[model samples]
Target chain A: MELFALSDVPEVREGDDLAAIVEDRVDLRADDVLCVASTVVSKADGRTVNLDDVTAGDRARAIAERLEAITGEAKDPRFAQVVLEESNDLVMEAPFILSETRFGHITVNAGIDRSNVPEADLLLLPEDPTGSAERLHEELGVPVVVTDTCGRPFRHGQRGVAIGWAGMPASRDWRGETDRDGRELGVTVESVVDELAAASNLLAGEGDGGTPFVVVREFDFGDHGGSDNLFREYDDDLIRQALQAWEFPG
Target chain B: MELFALSDVPEVREGDDLAAIVEDRVDLRADDVLCVASTVVSKADGRTVNLDDVTAGDRARAIAERLEAITGEAKDPRFAQVVLEESNDLVMEAPFILSETRFGHITVNAGIDRSNVPEADLLLLPEDPTGSAERLHEELGVPVVVTDTCGRPFRHGQRGVAIGWAGMPASRDWRGETDRDGRELGVTVESVVDELAAASNLLAGEGDGGTPFVVVREFDFGDHGGSDNLFREYDDDLIRQALQAWEFPG
Candidate 1:
């Protein structure tokens, strides 16, 4: 499939007519999938907080407090946990960078960023990634994905993942099918959109002039439902609990 | 890219030439990437233990004793440390599936299996996935990935991940570039092969008729080196220590 990173667009902000902006930059066909980085969308909409005035330690403390409120549980003062909770959840934490938050979402800084924002503020994830995705789908007549970078438990680096999806099938199930030899197939449900998001992120670098949104064409959707039919309402409490218990390197 | 699963080539047993079997069934070419389920490979090579006669508790105890030797650390049977240890580190642990392993590998039952084996035996992962990759690559003139099914921390179900790789680039880095608007790119490195493995696993299910291997022909590799170049000698102790101190859910 030919994947193209959407370019020549202004920075995305909150409440901005994303569909209008994308339409202006690229030709949005009926089946096209628009994958967006959540950071730009969050920044444009003013979903950020400044931390320059506060000490890093104090900033961490504030994040821990917010986490406690969200999770209804106390967290230790480890700088990583504080940063992680603020971002969403820690995907991977190490000396160089902490990959967390954005949950299954994929982007640089886990879609948490200090760059391209006011000097003192840290941008957070969009309030509702699935909602953002749905809006984009409505505007462009194509599937939409709110993406952020995520770290795999055993792997060393990060890759893009879909946080919220609309207008596309999140997963493609291939069970009970037949191979070339006509044998009954087993369990193979492909996360088609997620892999495409990761592939697009390769061109959308974290800090470069890479486009935050990518337009993927020349792909197959098969018989799966569009994004609207594929959206799932995840339990936030369960997600938070899973994050707290995720295994990461010491 | 379109993905097709290659399955049902007979139960691999000891003395079977795995590479030959794969090449005969699948149209493996020089540029293709083969994703092989590790279970079949393990079973073919006789890395299994039977436990049908023992209770689940006894089975856990027996597994724990073996793991104690491998980990060189005391384990608590009451807490399922052996299962956790087998996962290298626990990324996801629920009632039915446990995702953990030394190489950050994620798999159901910690890459352990009971089906398709003599009622008495349980399968383990291949001893050296990279080596398997290399051997397959040499024979097939394409990249090979040894993968197993793994569950995620919060997400339900399982995804296939690369446990060992050869002939392909495990990751592709897109750093120090400019976007369409000319902003400097920072930390975006795509773990392309792993994501592909995950996507391919959707069709390479863990049931009756699924092919143990998948052949992907059209991935963009760019200027990256082969998987052989990506292999690094890691300190086993560091990995063990990281697992011990890693935050895991009970």
Candidate 2:
């Protein structure tokens, strides 16, 4: 499979048609799978926020003060408030906020962006990333994977992950499958959408020279069982469960 | 960037020259990045083990008994012994085995495989994946990323990750970079090797049809600064610290 970024994508604005923008920039193939940065999706969906307009709640202010005391850096309560407003739950409330968004993705700061916004002070991840992807997929008639960059546990730095996807299953299920020796496979679920997002994110780095829209061509999902159960529920996630009873020493 | 899996990789044997195997299969290009799955690398390095050869000690047996009690599944003390022998630290001990391997990768069971071995009963990850990649990089005159599929804290399914990389930096440091509006970029370090491995993993799924090696062509690392730090140290990882202070409620 081949991947290329869409060049010269103008600064996105609220109410802009992402599908039309992509369709105008390139003649997309039927087999193409488009990976979109959530920045543009948020832009089109009016997900940007101005801190001046945000009111910091008691919780946000307390969290910000605690963060400031712990990290020795200036903390913005309005930003914390925005994260709180966008989140369903705060998985980690101190040192840094690890949260679950309304759309069920667990990420830092509710996947909020302090940068990458031209028209607003902050750009929130799409209100519903999977819904955003579905809209694009419906308009473009191809698979759409909405991508984001986030830090993960047990590893340094960050890479791309799929917050939402459409027109394709989120993962390829390898259960009951066998390896070359016909032994049962160890890896049961392969998150193909996340892999696609990571691949596109490699081509679309963050910066002035960044490319937000990437086209992945000729990828075959194969004749394997597919699954859309990409996000784990509260009872199923061990880390989330562990975090519930544990507190940061700070 | 284009990615394609190398076909017809025969069952890897111990003492195999991996570079020679790739060279014989395809005429590789200098610009291509080769992603070799850990299974093949382990096999080539004689990292397989026989269950009969292992002796479960007191610790392994006790741990296995606890796990079986908690999960209500038949647990093997010998398997737990293998995992203990392979691990430097156990981040999670109950309900499951989460460990830090000798080479610093934090994964379940120190990434030992009970499947994917043709001759042995178990397959262990390479002793030093970076060293394995370095040797291949030296022989082939191109980048090599040793890939592994792993589960993370929040996400549901597993995706590809880089356990070891050579001939290129692990991450593209975007420090001091600016967005389109000339604002300092929010994302600083982009883990390019992990992204590359994730891309290759999309094409090389686990099964009888699995392709252990994939070639990624024309992936540009750009003009950004590079860093070789992929795994997190203890002080730098917050989740590790959290895991330290908590125990499984089970």
Candidate 3:
């Protein structure tokens, strides 16, 4: 698939009609999937948090408390420990970044962020990322993704991942299909959207590049929404169940 | 960057020269970065474990013991409980994969595999993944990555990640640089190799038709080593110190 990174000329902010801004920059071809960085969306919404104003310990504690609220369980101290590690202990009063909510969906900022917001106010992830995607789809008639940066475990750095998707399929399951050698495929579902999101993030680094939107014009799935249609529902419970099933035992 | 997935090959067995086999199928350009799925590598090296042969309870206990051995601490039952919840209580045994190794990296199954391995044998991650990458670099005159599928903490599904890298710069630090708008690019260091690896993995899914090797060409790094010199001796003590600092409450 050929992927093109587009720099949306006009700046975007929360309530700025993201779909309209993107539409004005590029033609929304039916075959193209638009990948957007969440940071831009957050910035446009004026989500900004000042780290210098709070103590690191207090920030960590506050983050832990917010996590507890989202997950409906007291935060695990180990998780808090990991978050502290990722922040290098310099995060005094970090907004809760990302976590699996009580309903089981993965989200950014634990749906919380103060950076990019008007001073002293925080903007959480959209009440429903998929719903947000759907709204964009209705407006633009194309697939849309709201993405964010995430630090992976074991890996030394971070990458962009799809936090919410609409009008596109999240995965492409090829199980029961035949390979070139005619072997029945098993257990090989491809998370195509996430991969594309990561690739696009390379061009749209966290800096102020004005390149928050990525257009993927060429893909193997063709014009049909074979896999993209499956992303209609963002089921948090289903995601949680799947995660619960695959987590490694200690 | 250009990425190509190579597929429709024979099942590799123990003692196979994996690099040579892959080289035979695809021409390696000097700047091409080769990403190989750890499953195929482990399978070629005969890393596999059988679940049907052991009881699930025993498997859970074995895994817990193995985790403790690698971390040099007693396994917390609660943590174990979390793992069991994730693994669906189907774990039969722990393969005693690398733990407390020279690099201080501890992972489940020792980065081993039983899923894609031939029905009888279990596959283990290379003894030293980074060392393996280095050797491949010397032989093929290109960067090499030994990667494996890993589950994310809050996200559903798995993605391929670099467990070891050679001959390619792992990180590109763009911090301190200014954007076109003259904004300081702070903390914008990109894990370019990891992002590329994850992208290539999309075409190298875990199925029959999927290719085990992905050759990525056209990756541009200004002055970093192209493929002949990338590996370095990491200070295990320093890593341990860092881990300790992150682990213990100050």
* The best candidate in terms of lDDT: 2
User: Candidate 2: which pairs clash?
Assistant: none
Model 1 agreement with the true structure over A57-117: per-residue lDDT tens digits: 6645655566566557764434333255555544333222334344344223445554445
Model 3 C-alpha lDDT per residue in residues A119-191, reported as the tens digit of each score: 4434444545566677878888888877766654334555677777887677666556654345553334556
The best candidate in terms of DockQ: 2
Report the lDDT tens digits of candidate 2 across residue range A128-197.
8999999999999999999999888888788999999999999999998888888898899999999999
Q: What DockQ, on C-alphas, does every prediction get?
A: 0.16, 0.83, 0.16
Sorted into a CAPRI-style docking class, model 2 comes out as: high
Off by over 4 Å in 3: A14-17, A20-31, A43-127, A172-191, A221-250, B44-106, B178-189, B221-250
Residue A101, candidate 2: how far off, in angstroms?
0.6
Question: What local lDDT score does residue B192 receive in model 3, on the 0 to 100 scale?
Answer: 64
Give candidate 1 misplaced runs (Cα > 4 Å): A1-17, A20-33, A43-110, A114-123, A168-196, A202-250, B1-31, B43-49, B52-59, B62-108, B114-121, B173-189, B205-212, B223-250
* lDDT, candidate 3, B86-143, per-residue tens: 3311212332222332332344434444355555534556656778778878888988
Candidate 2's displacement at residue B152, Å, is 0.8
Evaluation by TM-score, superior candidate among 2 and 3: 2
